[model samples]
Target chain A: MRHDVILRVIAKLLIPFILLFALYVQFHGDFGPGGGFQAGVILAAAVIFYGLIYGLADARKLVPEAVVESMMAIGVLIYGGVGVAGLLLGGNYLDYFVLDPNPVHGQHRGIFWVEVGVAVTVSGVMLKIFYMFADRGRVDE
Target chain B: MAVTVLVIARSRNLFGVIVLGGLYSFLMATVLVAMDAVDVAMTEASVGAGISTVLLLGALYLCKSEETRPVQAPWLPLVVSLAVGAVLAYGTLGLPEFSDPKAPIHTHVVPRYLTELKQEVDVPNVVTAVLASYRGYDTLGETTVVFTAGAGVIALLRRRRKDRKP
Candidate 1:
């Protein structure tokens, strides 16, 4: 794949747009069809595309195994932390109404953070799975 | 779609089977879009067709590319699958027609979601509002489930340094 000039060139051209689309899906989800899950998968797909064309070692360097592992946990923590924040604000668990003076603004704030958490965890899990499978194949060879 | 499934079932080449499975998922995603579930269609396209195909190919790389013929007729499994399919089809007959306005789903919480989403959540996408705000706990649980699944896979498949033979 590395030696395939056309593939390498096309991949370099496409990867940046794919990454941008993922970000758009993540942040614009509240106004559009996509959300965290779709955004996360799209983001992972971009990296996996890079891995497929540039070699797994290079992809791993771009997003290290340790960083990927922590992403999985950190996302859940962010989500949980938002809920705790809601509780500390004297609201019920997972309540969005009390996050701010304006209830609607609070809802927006809460949803945004929660979606971000979901995107992070989902992408991490996806990359970790990809790396594990690719690594096993390398070990076998 | 049925023809694709039949071909996938009959094909011995695992690579073709994996590709056909992705085709099936793409077709399913199209059907979801027709049903107006764009969000689910996106997920089915990416996760089902895109990621799963790559993962299956990776697994195939580590194993045989061709499936061995069964020693005997697989009659029991065939009958069980047919029975389950029949039962599912029968169950669908009891449900309302597609996009029925008076359907339970449309008449239930959907009305409230549609009417109040703009004022309450202030989000244009009702689905996002419902998923992230109205059903926040469920999403939290789902996130935990994804995390748990990743942990489980890492536990089962990851190799330790000392365990790797030189």
Candidate 2:
């Protein structure tokens, strides 16, 4: 495989900012037009762009398949865990207000955690799909 | 638009159809965005322009893409589709006008979403709040649907560990 110096530099430069922006969007969701879903997609798109310019193998090396799989599971677990937290706090499922003494702050905290779950799951799912499709040739072998 | 669709349908070359399909989807996405439905536009542009085009091309690799005349239209499919479309349009009549403040959708639940959304979910984008919290159950189901589709595709493509069955 031929290495494109420009693409490599671009990936190096953009990836950190992409990740930072994703976090910013995730956290600042309450104050802005961005949120978990958009952040997830943008984050995944950055990784996808890297995989496209580089190779899938390189992308996988950076983010291993096992890690991706575990993340997928962990995301769901986090989401479900929040509901359980609410239940334990004497509220119905996913009742964020009951999760803490201060209802407003509790809502904020719950949404933040939920957004994290969403970001992880979305990025994991998208990467999985990209890998499956790009790995089509290997499967045929 | 009709001309574009006809040309796409009539194209003999597979590549031409693929390009045309992308163009069609691009145009549709632009229209959606122009109409202020940015979310729908983003989805259409991504899935339709990006993924659908790739999937179609990939499928084309697995089969011949030469266009052949349809022998016959299934009368049942045609009737069912038209009937369903008519019913859907009829249902739309009762729906609130687009962006109308007085519409029930805009008046009640929608207003609450637009107004109290930030205070509750703390998200400025009410759509995201609605998708992730207000109606999160539905979003969870949607996420599961994506996961299910991925699993289904993986299962379909996976090979047995050993070739020998006996």
Candidate 3:
């Protein structure tokens, strides 16, 4: 379904702001209500909105299925790899204090990385699910 | 179905229903955050508002858009749902207040986490520390669930490409 020209333009204008807000939610997570997962979903929703108003083909052009699959794996790997890094340093799994001698910095770094991993996994999953249903719905139609 | 009930109760068209459902899920997520159950809220809001609704509308393509005139009244399901709702509400009445500083949840292993969490995990947000470190295995299982879901989606949406490769 092609959106009207005005609505499409409005969507285009709004997309960037939505994305910015998601990013803001992500970074401000420590003090605020949102964190990686919520931010990731909100980000994906903006992309999904783009997909909805424009054609799914255009959305796929921007975010391919293969990319989403890789992102899913990378997210887990990132999370686990951080833990493994701690293990290799003679600490137990996911013990990020050993990442650096300074505990505060270590916590900061670890949380950032973990949140990145979460964000990647979640956004990828959202897009992947969208493709699945949207594709199936198209075939059914 | 749930959508019909929502529409009937809320007085909205299908598009409005979808948007309202999203809003409702988000509000529920907010409640979860207020309870400091960030993980559950994240999953609920994402899966409920983001994916499930899309999937429902997609499935709707295979079926009727408008509700069919009921051949029989849905009194049984209605009663069952109401009973379940009442039971859930009643259950909540016995629970401790949200964010109660004096709640048993705050007095138990949580204090230990607040004290030694930095020494052990170096994460400021105690929730992440517990989720990823204190209970790392559970986080791994959760990740596995995501992987399994990805696999399920792949299997469900598989397409046969018949041009000689396999």
Candidate 3, residues B1-166, lDDT tens digits: the string is 3554466464535555666677778777787888778767876787687766776677666565665466787799889999999999999999998668998887999889889875765555666556545666676667767767877887766653222247
lDDT of 1 at B79: 100
Please give the TM-score that candidate 3 achieves against the real structure.
Answer: 0.78
Off by over 4 Å in 2: A1-21, B1-8, B12-26, B51-100, B160-166
Regions more than 4 Å wrong, model 1? none
Q: Cα miss at B160, model 2 (Å)?
A: 5.1
CAPRI verdict (incorrect, acceptable, medium, high) for model 3? acceptable
Worst 10 residues of 2 chain A by lDDT: A132-141
Model 2 misses residue A136 by how many Å?
1.9
lDDT of prediction 1: 0.94
What digit string (tens of lDDT, one per residue) describes model 2 on residues B1-166? 5777889866788978997898899899888878876656765765577656765765565567787766786678879989999999999998877887686655567767777866776656666667666776676666666566766765765443234344
Compute each candidate's TM-score over C-alphas.
Answer: 0.96, 0.78, 0.78
Q: Give the Cα error of residue A57 in candidate 1, in Å.
A: 0.9
DockQ of each: 0.88, 0.36, 0.39
Superposed Cα deviation of residue B88, candidate 2 (Å)? 5.4
Which candidate gets the maximum lDDT versus the true structure? Answer: 1
Worst 10 residues of 3 chain A by lDDT: A28-37
